[model samples]
Target chain A: MNLYRAHVLICGGAGCLSSGCKAVLDKFNTELKAHNLQDEINVVETGCIGTCDLGPVMVVYPEGIFYQKVAPEDVTEIIEEHLIKGRYVTRLLYERPASGEQIPFYNEINFFRKQQRIALRNVGLINPEVIEEYIAQDGYLALGKVLSTYTPEQVIQVLKDSGLRGRGGAGFPTGLKWEFTKNAPGDQKYVICNADEGDPGAFMDRSVLEGDPHSVIEAMTIAGYAVGANQGYIYVRAEYPLAVQRLEDAIKKAHEFGMLGENIFGTGFSFDLEIRVGAGAFVCGEETALLASIEGKRGEPRPKPPFPASQGLWGKPTLINNVETFANIPVIINRGADWFKQIGTEKSKGTKVFALAGKVNNTGLVEVPMGTTLREVIFELGGGIPNHKRFKAAQTGGPSGGCLTEKDLDQPMDYESLVAAGSMMGSGGLIVMDEDNCMVDVARFFLEFTQDESCGKCTPCRVGTKRMLEILTKITQGKGEEKDLELLEELATSIKATALCGLGQSAPNPVLSTIRNFRDEYLAHIREKRCPAKVCRALLQYSISSELCKGCGLCARNCPENAISGEPKKPYTIDQEKCIKCGNCLDKCPFNAITLK
Target chain B: MAKANCPLPTSNLSEILDKYKQSPGSLLEILREAQAINGYLSREVLQLIAEELGIPESKVYGVATFYSLFKTTPTGQYIIRICESAPCHIRGAQDVLATIEKTLGIKPGETTPDGKFSLEFTSCLGLCGVAPAMMINDQVFGNLTGDRVREIINSF
Candidate 1:
């Protein structure tokens, strides 16, 4: 392939796709053809560029000119000005959030500058839809090496030496699990990919799978070679339609290339893969429960010890790993164990992929070396809190993780560090909370998720989480008692101890962590019947301030509950009992007269 | 104990296994084809697969159920799925369900009105952002308010 004069790379990930990246790609192609630069300029649709806030993002390679928030209208100017004249489009260049300096290079942005891409190395660089693009980049070379050269034991040893732990919440030794499956007494063993990502504001696995599916396929094949498994299943949620489609396509191409299937590389080792669409069951994330669901039963987790590695599926050994974990496998094999081990902290090696979302200026996927501080991830990489709002907390590990307050901002983000700081790295979902977020409401929101997703398989998870949710609910509603905080802590500990599965076991993390860090906020809610953020609706009363009220009647007319009851020109009084606290009246109040007390 | 029913001939099973051995992502297709030939994906079929592939029965069963499209249990004629995503909830899908109960008088996860439809609530139908979506035998209906639900049911 001849090197083109210029390579125009467009972000093809979900965020950019939703923002019409495909249209941008099409326009680029059309404009190139129109300008007679089709042969000179190559338009390539790549994976996520990570600056999702300014998408659909595009980059001109060789020169590395980064363009932000490009639309269909801006395509002509880009082609005419930059492509024709070799001049950069200053308007399209990303302006630094704080400094307002136009950044030309993609790597110069704070978001990319702080990130250490290991698992997400291939994303935004390769066209995920093409198989050869992946293979050319040494995609399945690790699996090839493992299959032909190393034994299963050697592969496991390499993984162990790499210090690669599970990125899927528990941070258990990935090699140890593979070793267990290898040693387990089973004529049949399986490799399962846990892509049923249920965490809110988390899409790291989905992004990886969508961006570089061959990495996962290669890793799984290597896993199959290591664990003596012939078949692999990817239990992806049906919601990730694009990721699923790409995976399916990749698997087909892999078979066509003789990379997968019987006698792969003529070594007499056979492995086949299949995509299994999950019906959005959060409990199916648990390996045992995932196995049961794959067996055509209700998705519910069973007890461990006879772990999935020992007696999984229909009663055979099964090895399950998340997409991000699998994405890291090939790199570990190719780069060598010591190379990976050198990247992160002594305990946690390599990089972690986080879905940076919620009140952050740069809301996208970020991969950083394990021991990177939360402050760096938030203020530096994430471009600080949105709207100049003061950062209150950052919620990690989704519903199963905890809230980290401003004081804990300097804490290093790793398996041990997060756990020591009263939070576990639960699937690398980092939701930044600004001053606008209510601590009690935040706890309640997570509790609501856990409560709904609870499989009802265990007493503690089912009943205890519900009870905790009730306490959180009561506190948010200003009906909480002074003893409710004590009750919450007690119930949280009990739930953590007594829950059968990991789902239940970590269910109380949000509550426990929030209460530990934001105890004063809870006290204010219970004691003073006040929400410091004024977010809790029940504790707030919407009153039309006499001075600000021009009696526009917007509030009274838009009031769904008909709570506001005064003449048009006079100051309105909201009937507290009639107000359902929906905030419609307050939203519709044009004069800003409606004040929440 | 009664002898376990063997669903497929050993020779046919071996051939099927050999055909898919070199095929990547042939697991689901093979299982579906095997089930079509044998009425269901039986333990005997799975065991034969294990023996041929040098894997275990538990692993086979695990792969089968992980994908929602693959059914281990035999289903009735039609699958009536209800959308239970956020938008559907906001549009009073619960009340629409209650009406379904009153009309057919059957709860979700049950076959009703002469076993023609098996009602099961599913996640967002992609139309969500647009409320109250439900699928009946692969046909999707969206923007269903509570009152319009009965009309939909009657049409089905």
Candidate 2:
């Protein structure tokens, strides 16, 4: 047990790694030792610091001073002026995107202030790789308490009181789900953590695993005790090597501390954990499909009737929960259900972590309470659309979720509200879109993903999505007809109804919601072959403006297709027939005469 | 789970097979390990895994083809997986992809003549914060533009 005067926590999440936080971390270590403040000042590499857009982020505590985009060179300055001399490095402090006001502390910053971090409490605060740090932050205390104090039924009762729903998207009541598994007649049951976060824009689960792996391990251990299961598996995606490595390390550390494995906390309870790496299958996110994949079979979904609670892996009851869902378990146990229930709405309790990205000014992992409006999450916390672009829509739930429009801005982001507004609370990957994004393309983009990831075991998903994709492709290529829109709607309806798994059923959500909200965009593509946002390359035709064109001939020389020709000191003209719509001329044009429509 | 002995079991195919020997559901893990060792799962490797696991040859082959990660055909040393999911699509993934193709002189799904790079599109790398991102083998490159992608390919 050691106490430091100040701890400098650097974000070591994947987002920060991409931004080269490793270099910044090494510099802090080297510089701190150089200044002989290594022992007094603790430099810790923690997981994601939430504000992912501004990576290489760090927070120094006891003061909790926040720094963003802290480079290697900036480390020496910070150690000299801030840590040693005790002066705030104003230059490295987080400046408000609009006001240019520097907020020195993390809690005062709009992004951190607005966020309700329950699942993400220790993410940026503690070193995930270190078990001692996790224990120091009260990480695995719940496991010890649950094992020693509460009965299995009593544990389930606590979850029911908390009203924690499945954060994996379907919003099934967590308590009831656990009770079902417990009640299911089986002694050799299993507890599984669904870390197979398949959503494209979503990385919150990965961040959690990278940031606070012990939390999930503790939660799963608690789940095993409640469910009377001795073994657990965390199915992580192969794409996230960092998460897998962290979880593996954390699991081993848990074993070393007697938090996991036989007779945990000297209670008659015993549990073991394993990591099952998913081989790039999006469909495996489905519980049944995930089980099958873990069983060393093709990661395809089977029709659900024997819902995992009763008949799961090897005909035994299995309590399967997502990484986020599991992350909440240890917290709910430590804080008590009454404390947890007070935080969120009646139906959806606690906060949801969202990987907010795309056209939003501030793209990061945001965790807001259940009733937080999309407007606050987008405008207030996200810093509005980037480059002052008019906010068009914000996409949630990835391919399975739908696009939410301006009308849904004030709508509370809960299970029911989001579903009523044409989107479901998916794994919470909120992607913001501006006026420049074409709604038709957005729909097509999501559709294409679902279509590609379709497991082909089911017919409707296999063939139907392909047909819808064909029509969408035709529309994008300026080859759509009036009947195609109706056909798309027809296909979307049937696929939603007939598709076997949740993937196929919710596959058309993006398409249907886009059509419902932006029918005009679809109509424009179908009727006039015009892309309102000029995103469809085939529908775009670039022309030189006579007034603006200085006859620079840059467009002519740069056009790979040799489509532009003009005389010196005269307006240029593009030969429409010869133009390939590559937009090469547009990029190279110095006069800014070219405009696409 | 035999996971402790060899975390990935990349070097020896027989060791992976023996580890999860005759297990009910260990095909995916074995295939992944075999692929890691051999670069891509060859026909002989698939058959060997099937016989070792007591699963039918066809079933082993089916599992291999089902997963997008398990490559049946050979690929270049550097498998550049550019994300084609909605998040990257909105963030100029197409432009970044085109730049890679032009620089490498190879289209998507085609290997470079010298066996240095094989370009392909994957569903999502889950790093949408840095959209228009790609994963070259294990290392991730994000916030890509034409110039950045070109520079990356040239350096590779």
Candidate 3:
């Protein structure tokens, strides 16, 4: 084995890959060879280091210098100044926006300082494509320990003591679920990893799979042992091709190393795993719907009580846990359950990884303790909202979650506290909205998604959600009557109570939460026939300010419908009848004269 | 009926079917790989897959139609999937989408005249941190601007 003097870790996660990390990695290869340091220096392509806003990011080991926004051209400077001369690159280091201080080390940076990485511990540190690096980092140690020393009942006890709940939105107790599947009378019980993360703005599961695929594999094997199962299936999304590729590679490597397949570590325990790609259905995130899809049927949710633990996967008992939930298992066993229980809140133990995005300065994946406040996540860790915009609300849990306003900023972001604030932690998709955002429009946007993705399996979810969306759409279109608000409340309540599944039950959350938190915005849309945030196109009236209009004819020429009319050097008038409200004229105007009232 | 030319060789299709013969639940994988081989899932190809897997033709067709990833109609040489999720919507996704539409001379669900490009809106490609992102085939492009879109399509 060869050891490198210095290692340059390039982020190869989907987020960084989209931002040209591939180009940056290629440049580093060429430059390191050009400097004749190729043999001595190592460039390892790893998974997401979480700070996506600073990509293409790289952290050079030995010094642990954290570099941000690196380009292909800057490769030469990094190799020559940092690697060759033994001096850190001052310009490339991540500078704190608040203090303007250049922090070279990753742990020193505020964005990473507060983060407690258990699921993402090996993500940016080891090469995922190589299983040896993962093994060196004590990757399969927990599985070996579990199979060698502990019984199935003992393993379940550890999970129960740890208080680990499902991170896949519902927060079900994982150990209790495992115990049920074990006790359930079945000759062919199975274990499943739920990687079908359909929450629109969330990519936490994707990152875990891409970065540390072995952790999930090990966890699943442990789960297989605990549940008295020989077969495990990972139901992943087809949209996440990178993650799928990595998981496939990891499974193959584990098989080769005897960690997978029939007998492992000279023990009689035998487990095999296979990957099943989901076909673009949001409802498949639900365990029963996912099982139906695996059985080659349409992804639709069914009634519970005969839950997955009792009867699942071709009417056999199955243990199903979310990707993040399984990712925590190996760590819980290796470190012991008491350590895991001490980290998070009373009921919701351990950290939750959030796909932090929208209107914030630092947009990336964040893993904070379950009890971390919304204010710390948004202001301190996220660096506040971008463009100096005032915070309006933070929309958590996607369509299933409600909006958290300023009053809830101090609330701890655990499962119970978030639900108490009128929102549930639905897979940790924290979308921060600013003052410029329209509350009614946000509700309408989420409603549109839920409405489109509704499986039509039940009446309340199918028809009731449609009715609620119709009302929300009308309000956004400036055609809402005063009575619409009361009607929306009535419809939302009934749907929440009568819906068959979680999707239908939580479908009214965004609507109900917006009305509860920002009733003034809805009143403005309905009563005043105005969108105070200027987002609803139907409420916006475009006109040229006479004093500021240069009459350049740019707007007239650019309009697809030719809706702007004027003479040269004279103010133009918008033909609102002909205008399609496409906002083309506003984009074309050079003088910035057009105003939407 | 319109399957005059074969997208993949007959031997490759048989091999793929044989690999998944034991696992009946691999319908999603079979459809995904078949779509990748062919530009879209034509009825003729679906029938062939159904016969190979020993499942009914109607069941195969139903599975194909259930997924958003499997296209029933032929796509352009280049497929551009623009994300229109809430995160992207908040961060100028509309403007970038409008720019793509204007540049390509097509709407969200239409193909170009020469079949060079097709524009479609996807739910989310999970690149929300870099909002206003699009996937051109398997390669994702993020933090989009009008110039970036122009450069990308022009290269293709």
Residues A424-508, candidate 2: write the lDDT tens digits: 8899999889999999889888888899899998899999999999999999888999888888899999999999999999998
Fnat of every candidate, listed in order: 0.02, 0.75, 0.73
**Clashing residue pairs found in predicted model 2:** A295-B25
lDDT of 3 at A597: 83
- Second chain TM-score per prediction? 0.68, 0.89, 0.90
TM-score of 1: 0.82
Q: Residue A155 lDDT in model 3?
A: 99
Q: Per-prediction interface RMSD? A: 7.7, 1.1, 1.1
lDDT tens readout by residue for model 3, A1-597: 668999999999888998899999999998888888889999999988888878999999888899999999899999999999988879998877766788889888788998998888888889999999998888999999999999999999999999999999999898999999999998999999999888878889999999999999999999999989999999998788899999999999999999998898779899999999986788888888899999888788899979888899999999999988888889999999999999989888999998889989889898888999999999988988877789999999988999999999999889999999999899999999998999999999998888888888899999998998999999999899889989999999999999888888998999999999999999999989999998998889888899999989998988889888999999999998888787877888888999888
- Relative to the true structure, how large is the alpha-carbon lDDT of every model? 0.80, 0.88, 0.89
Clashing pairs in 3: none
TM-score of chain A of each: 0.97, 0.98, 0.98
Docking class of 2: medium
lDDT per residue for candidate 1 within A363-466, as digits (tens), equals 78889999899999988888887678898888888778887888888888899999888887989878777777788887887777778788787899988998
Model 1, residue A381: C-alpha shift (Å): 0.7
Q: Model 3's CAPRI class?
A: medium
Model with the higher DockQ, candidate 1 or 3: 3
Chain A only, candidate 3, TM-score: 0.98
Worst lDDT run of 10 residues, candidate 2 chain A, spans A48-57
